[model samples]
Target chain A: MPDDSLSRMSLIEISGAIARREVSSMEVVRNNLEQLEEQGESLNCVARLFPEEALADAELADQELSSGNSRGPLHGVPLTHKDMFYRKGKISACGSKICEKYLPSVTATALLKLDQAGALDIGRLNMVEFAYGLTGHNEITGDVQNPLSLNHIPGGSSSGPAAAVGAFLSYGSLGSDTGGSIRFPASCCGLVGIKPTYGRVSRFGAMPLSFSLDHIGPLTRTVTDCALLTQIISGADTNDPTSLNHKKTDYLENIDSGINGIKIGIPATYFDEKVHPEVLREINKSRDVFRSLGANIVEIDLPDNFEVCNSMANIITASEGSSAHAKWLKEKPEDYGSQTRERLMSGLFFSSVDYLDALKLRNVILQEFLQDVFSKVDILHAPVVPIPVPTLAESDIQSNPGFIEYLMLLGHCTRPFDYLGLPAITVPAGQTDNGLPTGFQLVTPPLEEALLFQAARAYEKENSWFFPVLNDN
Target chain B: MSNQWSDFIERNIDVPEVKSALKSAKNHSDIKQNYICLVPFEAEPSGFSKVISTWKLKQEQTEDQNA
Candidate 1:
């Protein structure tokens, strides 16, 4: 591939080229690191670059490829992860002031697995402080800007990963989704992000926001890339007690099978309500595209208590988040960002009874979702963020009076999946009237990530809406 | 926010949004609905293992059918 085309290739494409010896791993890694250095500051995406370590690793990968020693599918592929994942003996600041100097003694299982597969990690990407905020604001580090329009906010806590992938700075990024971190940023940046079924991917070394809700997954430019990364990173690990024990298999095997008869559910309630006209228009067109591909779209009413149950997710998130940061909140609250501080402090007010009750209610809500919603549809299609992507100024919670309400509404569509521990994928459905990206989310029951990938791949194949060229207007 | 809650919150952290966020949590229909309800005294806190196991089995069965 040419130099210009090299930067835009997907992970699968790059991996295949490396396998066939078309491009040396050293060439791919050096080009990506150069691009990261060139465009990274403009996007506010990179937290730290691993130039020396990455170059050495890339040279080794090239030598191994030359010697007929391919490590795996991702041989020599250079990628970045949200800064929250720990790499032993290195600082994993987690985009927070309190942990600015905190270093972990052990690496994340996902990172180890990626290394084992011959993937080179060239840098750490930026994220919201403690992965707390939904918007891409980080008072400790600078905010991550949208790659499409630098003025707009990159929907976050996975903001850096999204921006890096959007600008082709890295092949993909590993991100943690507690509420909408992975899905939201993917939607905002027009990338493919999968928040796999909780526990499907072990959360061994990723920083936690909410114990019950945090999910580790990938943000890539294509559904096949998402599948490939998921295949590499998923499975049970004893280190994470909550990790699900399931048979490991190749996720890419049936990803291209298509969703000819897949029953896609369109929520008749909250998903469509209060949505921006352009977002709604794009989602409706996406639905038609699914129809054209021979899939069935069913108008289904989610459980009446769905929205109410969904609200409880915030309670769980707050209480658990506060607990995680309790020591810090007690000692050096002044060190934290105002939004993160306030949200975590609010958890201190909720009684133990409140947390336990929310947990029980979560069980009831999951049951209702599985029986009432999943029973009728193979997948649920909805907007990841209800409104059009907001600009940084518009989403500033401190200045905007309606910020909390806007935040809640933006999270409304994606929160329920997190609450139920289900698998959901966000794909760029279309652009808004202003040319900013908007995405439609496809959700399925737990452990049905294969189905989600199939549907997303079908959509991506028919409509090439992955990364729209940046309009610098 | 209630005086007791406000007093408790202010004792440790004195942010303005603390009171407001607590007030919103109190008023949030979902939180309030769950907070006011009563679970059975003998009902155990569900670990979600069953839900996950059932879903996993179904997924396996689906894959088997496809294969």
Candidate 2:
């Protein structure tokens, strides 16, 4: 196969080709690095590139493959990690200057797992500073331009991961989610991201913004790829106390199971209110597709504390983030990005009572949510973002105090799941009339990622939607 | 307010002393209700479990037969 063709193949396809010895790991890595060089400038996805080390690793992988010792699907696949994930000996700037030269002495469990699975780390990708913002703007490292449209925001926190995957610079990428960091960028970039159930994946060495809500998952071109990646990374880790003790199951096995007679709940009130018309239309289109696939679409109402749940997430995130960065704030406050510093500083203003109240309210809301929604529906469907990808100029963070409010609103349908610690998956439903991609979120009860992927796969396969053009690719 | 809560408040906010003052002064009873109940809701878990399990079993059986 041609180098370009090898670079363009999906994670599963690349693994198959490698297993058959049709391609060498070095060849695949070289192709992907070449693609990265050709497309990385326009996408602005990579924050750090280590081509020399990557080639050496690829050579080693090729030797292993020749010896009939393979590391399964991820072995020899070229992938990247979000800049925030700690990789020992690699500079993890977290897209900020405060830790510009800081290299961790330990590797994140997520990165270690992927490495053990035979994935070659190409480089670190850019992200919102400390994973705070959602607009993919970084004052220190420069904003990551969207591959689909240079003028648009590439959705943040996991911005580079999504942009890289969407641009075919990498087969798969790891992104951490507190709010919709992983899924939001994935949706904006027209990729698939799963914010697995809290504790489903370990966060041991990941830089923390909000410990209570952080989840690690993958961004890939297809839901099956997400499943494959998730299977390799997820499980109990002794390093992370919060990691679950659940048995690991084959995620790719039931991905194509039809959604026949599946009960999908649509929140009648909360999701329908104040949503952009274009977004609503796309969601309805997805619903129509699901209905045609024998899904039982049922209308349901959100919990009594739904709005409070949104507020609680904000409070907890801000407070916990401020506490986490206290030392850096005290010493190198000027080193941080203006927006990230401002947001983290704002968290420092919440009274301890307020923080505790937020936690108390979180418990109350989760209890109410479990009693209400999770018990009834197999999965809850909603728009990942109420609005399409807005231009970078429109969301001027300097003048607008409402920027965070608007961001929270865009994450309104998603934050509740974070607060409840439920598993959610976002997949491309279709595009708006103007051709911007929109995603439908499928949220399920805790640790039911298989069901969410099942429904997502069914919907994705049923409607073969067109992918957004990668400008100048 | 207690010392632990006071310490927690101090560490999180920018003006920790101000927050401590506010927490001490503000009445706990002044808590406002921000909850919005959509409707009376009930969940039938038994029915939901049965449906999901049956679906899984059918799927496995179909795969087995194909094999």
Candidate that would win on TM-score: 1
Q: Please give the DockQ score of every candidate, comma-separated.
A: 0.41, 0.08
TM-score of chain B of 2: 0.32
User: Which stretches of model 2 miss by more than 4 angstroms?
Assistant: A467-473, B1-67
**Least lDDT summed over 10 consecutive residues: which range in candidate 2 chain A?**
A464-473
| Regions of candidate 1 where Cα sits further than 4 Å from its true position | A399-402, A466-473, B1-15, B34-40, B58-67
Per-residue accuracy of model 1 over A1-473 as CA lDDT, tens digit each:
23658888878888888889888888888888888888899998999889999999999998888888988888998989999999988889899888888899889999999998889988999999999877898888988999999988888999999999988888899999988999999999999999999889999999989989999999998888888899899999999988888877667788779999999999899788868889999999999999999999999988866776556778888889988988888789889988788778667777777777777766666777788988899999998888788898767775234555666787888888888888999999989988889999999888888888889888888898555322111
Full-model lDDT for every candidate:
0.84, 0.78
Cα lDDT tens digits for candidate 2, A1-473: 23667766778888778777888888888888877877887878888888999999999898998898988667888888899888889899898888788899999998888888888888989898899877788888888887788888889889899889988888889998898898888888888899998888999999999998888999988878898899988999999977877777788787778899999999887776867889889899999999999999999888756766666677778789989998887788778876676667656656776666665555556556665876687888988877888877776463144555576677777777776678899888777765778788998866688998889888877775744221110
Error of 1 at A180 (Å): 0.4
Model 2 docking tier (incorrect/acceptable/medium/high): incorrect
